[model samples]
Target: MTDQAVFPRLASLAGRLVTARGWKRLGLAALAGALATLSLPPLHALPLLWVAFPALVWLLRGSDRPKTDFTIGLAFAIGHHVPGLYWISAALFTDIGRFWFMLPASLLGLPAVLGLFLGVGTVAYGWARRRWGLTGWVEAAGLALAWVAVEYARGHMFTGFPWNLIGYGWVPVLPVLQTVSVIGIYGLSLLTVLAAALPATLVATKPSWRPALAGLLGLALLAGWGGWRMAGQGLGDVPDVRLRIVQPNIPQALKWKEEAKINNLRRLIDMSGAEGWDRVTHVIWPETAVPYFLSSDSDNPDQAPLTRLLTQIAPPGGALITGANRLATNEAGDYIYFNSLFALTQGGTVVASFDKAHLVPFGEYLPLRGLLPKGVKAVAAAADFSAGPGPRAVSLPGAPAASPLICYEVIFPGAVMPREGERPHWLLNLTNDAWYGQTAGPHQHFAITAVRAVEEGVPLVRAANTGISGVIDAYGRVRGALPLGDSGNLDISLPQRAETVPLYADYGDAVPVVIWLALLLGIAAFRPRPT
Candidate 1:
C-alpha cells in the first residue's frame, strides 16, 4: 500500500500542490473550498468532497505557520461559505427600497464572520499537527476533529447560524444520511470529514492506505446499519391528527402593505378551507402568517376580528396554529414585540403561545440599535423583539403536544426540545422564507429543517411562507412537500414520533464530542513524527 503501489501519480501531484506558495497556495485553497460547496443542497454532488477536502489538506499542508494556517483556513472557508450562502442576500432585494445598501454586507460580511470560526479551528489543527508532527491518516483525523469542533462553535456562537453543515451534503444520499440519527449533524459531519479526507492519504505514505481502507469500511458499516434502519419502514402514523400546511406564497413586497393585508389574510383562509379542510384535524400556517394583531388586548383596533377571522379554518375542537407578531409592554413600560406562535380554538380563543427565543441577530432584532446610524434598524425590528423565556411546547385540544420553532430557531441542535414538561410528539417549525424568495436559502433551510426530525426522533411539520412547506417524519424522510413559490395547502396524516429516542436526542452533541476526543487521544498516542 505504498504511494508508488497505488497512488504514485496522485502522490506526486499532491506533493507539488503541497509545496505551492504565495497567491497560488491561496488560489488553489479557494478553488478547493468552492468545489466542496457543490455537495450542498439543491445540488448534491457529494463525491466532490473527496477531491475538495484532500486538496484543502494539501493547502493547509503547504502553509507551515499558525498565522499562515489561519489565512488559508479563512480563505478556504470564505470561498466555501460565500458561494454556498450567496442566496442569503436575496432577502435584501425583497425590500430594495430600504435594504438596498445592506446587500454587500449580507453577501460577504456574514460569511466572513462565519469563516472566522474555521480560521480559528485551523489554527488549533495546525498547532496540533505541528506539535505532534502528525501525518497520514492521523493527520486526516486531526483535520476532521478541528472541522467538526468549529462547526459546533459556528452553530452556537452569537445566537448561532448553523446553515449548511457539511453533513448536509449527504442530503441526496439518504442511507448514509441516516447516520445523523445517532451522531447528530455535528457527529455526521465528523465522519463525513474523516471519510472525505481519507483519500488525501493516497499521496502521503504507505500506512495511509490502511486508514483509507478503514474509512471505506466505516462508510460500509454506516450505510448497512442505515439500510437496516430504513428497512423497518412501517413507521406508524399518529392517529386522528390529520394535519394541513398552508403556503400562501404571498409576495414579500406587498405582504405588509396596508392595502394588501386583508387580501393576504383572506387568501390564507380560503386556501386552508379549500375542498379537503373537512378531514383536517389541525391546520398550520407559516411564520407571521397572521400579519395582523391577534390578541384582543393588543393596540391594533382590528384584533378582535383578526382572531375570529382565523377560526374560519379551525376544526370544531381543533386549533389553528400560526405565527404572529406578539405585542407586549415589558416591565420597563417600554413597548416590546415578539415573533411568536399562537394556537387558536374554533371558538376563537387564543389557547397557547410560544415566543421565538433564538432571534436572528439582525433580522428579528438589532444588536445595538441606539449606537447605529439614525435610521439603521433591522428589517423586522421596527421595535426590537424581547427574547422569550426559552423553548416551550403546547397541548391543544386536537393535536398531540408540539414544540413550535419560529423560523431559523429550528436550525439549532438539541435546543428544539420543549423545556415545559415532557418530550413533544412533533416539532412545529413556522418560517417566513418569503424574504429569501425563490432561492437556495429556502431550499437549504428546508433541508436543514428536515434533518432536525432525525436528530430529535420526531415528526417535523414545517409551514413556510412562499413554499417548502411539508412533513418530515422521524426518519428524515420528506413524506410530502410543496415546492418553492407554490401556493397551496398540503393535507396529510401526521407521522408518529419514533417510539425510541435517538442517541443524538438523548445525548445532544455530547455523542460527537466523545468521538472528537477519542480521535485526538489516538493521534496523541502516535509519537511526534520526527519533526
Candidate 2:
C-alpha cells in the first residue's frame, strides 16, 4: 500500500474505535486525559499526547448534544488535572496532624474545579461545529482554538493557576522550547493543541490530509527555526557577579515555630558565610527565611537578635537579598504587612526592598475575607499579607539591577518584569517549596522558573527553602543547581544575559492573540461549500 492509501484506512479504523457510546465513551475520555498528563514535567512522555488529543477530538466529534460533549470533556480534564495536581496534597501533609482529613479533598476537589474550564470549552466546540456544520480540518482547527481559549481563560481567571500547561511538555526538548522566546508559552500551547488534535482530521468523514500535513509542516518549521537560533551558541561569558544560593532544606512545619526560628536563621547564616564566602559577592536566602520581622522595630526586642545575626553574614560591600515580612503604617493609622524581598548591606541596614506585588490568593490572603470566620488564617502565615504596589528592580553593590519574584510570583508569564523602570539584568526568585514536600510541586515550579529566563532573555537566580535552587541562563539551561530536598549551597558565577530582548518580551501576548484570531478566521473563511 502507498502512503496515501494507508493513512485513510488507519484513520477510518481509529474513527470506528473512538465512536463508542455511554460508559465506553466516558471511560475512553478519562483514559485519554490521564495519558495526556504523562506528557507534562517530571514525566515528559510527550508522545502520549498524540493519542490523547486525537481521542478528545474524536469524542467531541461524535457528541450530538452540547451536554454530552461537556460531559466527555469534563471526564478528560478530571483525569488530566487530578494526577497532574495530586502533588498539591503534599502541602496539606506538612501539618498532617491538623490537615490530614483534607488530603482526599485536596486531591479530588481542585481538579474538579479546574476541569470546569475544559468542560465549558468543549461545550463551545460542540456548539460551533454543529451550528456551522464544520468537518475535517475545519472541525479540528475549531476544536483546537476552543481548547486554547479555555486554557488562556483558566490562566487568567481568579488568581490564575497555569500549572502543567501543554506547552511545558516541550520543556525536555530544548530546540522545541526555544519557540517561547518569540511567541511566549501560550502561543506554543496553541500550536501544541492544534498539532495534537489534527490527527483526528484523518478520521473525519472527508478524511483530508491537508490539516494533518499542515500541522506536521508547522512543527518542522518551528524546530528548524529554533535549531538555527541555538546553533553554535554555548553558555556565554560569566558576568562579574558571583552568587551563593543557600538551600537549608528547612521543613515547613519548623519554619515558623518560635523555638525552631533561631536554628533556621542560624542554618542560613552558617551556609551563606560558609568556607567559600571569601570570593562570593552576593548571598541569597529563600522565601520567608527570616520568620520574624527583620525591619527596624524598636518596640519588638527581636530586632536586636535579627541584626546581630545578619551583621555576621552580610557580604563585604555586597548585599544579602532574602525573603521576609515587613510592616508599614498607612495614613489610616493601620499596620499593613507584606511578604517582601529585602536587600541588607554589610552594615546591617536594609538599603533596598521590593515588596511582593502579586500575592498568592488563599495562601497569603483570603479571597472572600468577610465570608470566612473571624479567627481563620491563611495556609502560609498567621496574618493576612497585603499586596505591594508592583514589581521593582533593586540595585546591589556588584550584581546588576534585579527584579525580585517571591514564591509563586515567578510562575506568571508576561507579569514578572518590572512595569516602569529599565529592564532588570537578572530575575531574583526566592521561594519556599518546602510546603509541598518532595513531590512534583518543586520540580514543576523549577521548570516554570526556567521558562522565564528564555522568555525574557535574562538569567534567573532561584533560591528555594528546600531545594531546586540554581542559576539558569537566558537560554533556559540550568548552569548549576542544588538537588531537591537536600541541604547545600551552590557557589556559581552568574551567566551573562542574552544581548537582545526576546520578541515575546517586547510584544507581550500579541503573538498568541494574532495566532488565535487567524485560526478563528480560517474556520470562518474555509467553511465547506454546498455538496
Best by TM-score: 1
Clashes of 1: 0
TM-score of each: 0.96, 0.94
Cα lDDT, all candidates? 0.84, 0.83
**lDDT for residue 518 in candidate 2, whole number 0-100:** 93
* Candidate 1 per-residue C-alpha lDDT over 1-531 given as tens digits, one digit per residue, 9 for 90 to 100: 223325667877787678888888877878888888989988978889988888888777777799989988988898898889998788777677998888888889988888789999999988887777667888898899999989998888777788899998876677787888888888888998999898777776453567778887998899989888888776889878888899999988888999999899999999999998988888999999987755534234567667777877888778898998887786889878888898887766788888888888778778877778886778766767878877777787777888889999888988999644788989999998988876788889888887899888899999999989999998888999999999998999899888788899888888888888888788888735563
Candidate 2 Cα errors over 4 Å, as ranges = 1-13, 16-18, 296-304
Sequence-dependent TM-score of model 2: 0.94
lDDT of 2 by residue, 1-531 (tens): 111212756766566545678888888888899999999888889888888988888777778998898888888999999889898888877677766766776799788888889999999999988888887777778877887888889888998888888898888677888899998899898898888888777765666667778988898899888888778667575666678899999988898888999888888898888898988878899988988776644234557667657756777877787888887777999988999887776655777777887787757888899997776666666778888877777787877888889988888888889757688988999999998887888888999988888898888999999988999988888899999999999988888888778999898788888989998999899977666
